[model samples]
Target: MAKYSLYINSDCSLIIEFEEEISLELSRFILGAKLAIEKASLEGFVEAVPAYNSLLLIFEPKAFQVERLLQETKELLDKTKSLAPSQSTRHDIPVCYHESLAPDLAYVANHAGIPTEELIKLHSQAEYPVYMLGFLPGFLYLGNLNKALHCPRRENPRPRVDAGSVAIGGDQTGVYPIASPGGWHIIGKTPISMLDSSRQNPAIAKPLDTIIFKPISLEEFNQYDH
Candidate 1:
């Protein structure tokens, strides 16, 4: 059994936080709870947002019932299990890790005591799961970064990181999704559009989705129809 705590975040919101390190099992468990809550259609329930280690449940302010809802949620979540991995949508995203596209490739490689090509090789080989969407309109927090590729966030966050920039910060790697100020060390760039507000599902991927990075040359990247 996992230890967790539920607390009123606001009059219209409650939070369930798991006291555990972030992991694939935790992500699956949290998302499972979110799906179960969504399925239950609890009274006044608006939505349940799941992250790496927690779930934030929102409800109609006027109909808020914190105590009852907490108990009900505890019961609901207790019965929930990790979601099946097969349900995850998989994407093989292409990335150009050339020096021009990757400003910190050499720096990161040096930090890991490996050459840039080896660093790229290690990064591209691993499969990363989208733990959550946040920080920007469609930014994905990817998990399972190769430990050798792990490095600290840049001391100076850039004022603007172009959309599609694949970066590493702490223990996770992710794509920028959209142009924005960021602190992650950029190591490559993808050409895919990760956000489209016109669509009902604005994000290109969702929690539990898996992304595989495929290294591409500058010519191939330029030829890609973005």
Candidate 2:
């Protein structure tokens, strides 16, 4: 990985870029940078947010000058190069793939020329990585779906997707934590509250978390709902 000069934004943010594309290595690099920044008790360091191919470092000016922090951040980035990848935390998310639950199951199955059962099997088999949290609160963008299952977004997006709606777009899979307009083909729904703002920890998954979807019956989902 080639390291470039650190980029400082007027918003008290610094960006250290290695690559411009998304990959396992890039994700690991983002995580490594995150860990390094968090570990440093720099007076002005506010928060570090990781994206598809870069990390955003936020700081305050009163406690730490931008110029000094920029140098310190570059040092931190250099240190991350020697660190190991994060040991991922696995989360088994339960999904109910019933016809009633998965409105787009028929369409997705037809598009792949596969039976619905096979479609469900393919979806639940892979261990997806938590790429980033964006677009919505606690809305996960997991990657590496079985390529055969890759499909385009709905031609007409629904005005309001149900909360806990599990859907797929292209080669990525995600869960809708709140009802909102969505274009991803809905294939299932989970009872898990991935984003409960009332809870101390609102987001259920974090960057580098491994997500394994477990299929459940509608009856089982109802039982958990209660």
TM-score of 2: 0.91
Instruction: Give the residue spans of candidate 2 off by over 4 A.
Output: 1-5, 61-64, 81-86, 198-200
Clashes (N, CA, C under 3 Å) per candidate = 0, 0
Q: What is the lDDT of residue 165 in candidate 1?
A: 95
Model 2: lowest-lDDT 10 consecutive positions? 79-88
For model 1, residues 53-156, the per-residue Cα lDDT tens digits are 88999999988988889989999888987788988999899999999999989889999999998999999998888999888888888888888888999999
Q: What stretches of model 1 exceed 4 Å from their correct place? A: none
Across 1-226, the per-residue lDDT of candidate 2 in tens digits comes to 4354578765667876664668777787778778888999777788888778777788885664877888888788777752254477899999999999999998999998999999999999999988888899888888889988998999999999999999988777899988999999999999988887887658897877889999999999999852
